[model samples]
Target chain A: DVKVTQSSRYLVKRTGEKVFLECVQDMDHENMFWYRQDPGLGLRLIYFSYDVKMKEKGDIPEGYSVSREKKERFSLILESASTNQTSMYLCASSAGTSGTQETQYFGPGTRLLVL
Target chain B: AQSVSQHNHHVILSEAASLELGCNYSYGGTVNLFWYVQYPGQHLQLLLKYFSGDPLVKGIKGFEAEFIKSKFSFNLRKPSVQWSDTAEYFCAVNALSNYQLIWGAGTKLIIKP
Candidate 1:
């Protein structure tokens, strides 16, 4: 089965601290995405990578950045974590190209708490 | 702009009761639709998806959705819901531009035994 994994299930970070959230997928998919889930707000894309060393900004990329040095791993970075940034982070991967195999599979997610 | 909307903020149903969750999208052109579920503390799982052909799509756990193009709606339904079905469900959309999904706020469903 295809598996997507995130490094943390729960994370606590002090305000103004830099935070890193890591995600890895075993499917060797070409597209990886980062999203944040919040109460009353649907999942908002933070960043996405279509290929190794390639990245694109999603709708809500403000205050966030991402890295995809390798095809299977994608990292989301918070330059300066803030209370408002505390939310559930999800990582997803899919076959970057078109065709019937474009469904995205997601990791369990990381719940981040900034205080 | 392109976006998705889930009308129900919350819903409560008894086990064996019918279920329906409304999802609408503002994007008119070619688009992909999806329904996803998140059981507390678990990752979001795809309930179903609609790409081309047959507007009606069935997914795991007996969940089904109909994509009404004229209405711009994709509503999820299950003939009978179970207590185990309690979770938050999301409606998502991505224009033909690729897989950049725009998600709805989500509906919290609580099924009572």
Candidate 2:
């Protein structure tokens, strides 16, 4: 069984504060992703890392950045938290050749609120 | 750019009812598809995936999906839905050049017992 763990299940931050959401996978997957899910908006990809220290922007990258210091860890950072940035953040990891759509395991998700 | 669409936003059904959720994608070329389920207060789990070969793929919890290339659709279905089957179903697509996934808005299923 693959386990994807997130640092916090819920978080509340003040406006203009920095927020970091961490995710770790036990499966040693090569590809990791960060997404923010909102009602009616679905899961919008924020960033992805294919390898260590490598990153790619997804559809919505503004106000968000990612860190992949190691294979097992992926962190999403909001430089300055805003009310609009409050959302359900999700982290997922997938391994092996992706051409054939491998299962991307997801963490429990961190629901953040900016006040 | 690839995009996925789920026509059904919220569905309510009685127990033992048949279920089907529609998902459509806009990408003419080769692509991979997947279905995921998120239970209440739980993480998203892989229900089924379609890369190639057989179009009809069975998944956990008696759920299945059919991939229709001509229609550019991957619709999830189940013969008899249980109350436990209630969850938010998301359909996703992956294009060749980009390994990232394009996701649908998702369908929230509610089963009444």
DockQ of all candidate complexes: 0.63, 0.75
Q: After superposition, how far is residue B105 of candidate 2 from its true place, in Å?
A: 0.3
- Candidate 1 interface RMSD after superposing interface residues: 2.1
| lDDT, candidate 2, A57-85, per-residue tens | 98899999999999999999999999999
Q: What fraction of the reference interface contacts is present in each model, in order?
A: 0.59, 0.68
Give the range where candidate 2 chain B is weakest over 10 consecutive residues by summed lDDT. B93-102
- For model 2, the stretches where C-alpha displacement exceeds 4 angstroms are none
Cα error, residue B8 of model 1, in Å, equals: 0.4
Candidate 1 accuracy as TM-score: 0.97
In candidate 2, the residue pairs with backbone N, CA or C atoms under 3 Å apart (3 or more residues apart, or in different chains) clash, namely none
Q: What CAPRI class is candidate 1?
A: medium
Off by over 4 Å in 1: A99-101
Worst 10 residues of 2 chain A by lDDT: A96-105
Per-residue error at B7 for model 1, in Å? Answer: 0.7
lDDT of 2 by residue, B1-113 (tens): 67899999999999999999999999998888999999998899999998889999998889999999999999999999999998999999988667888899999999999
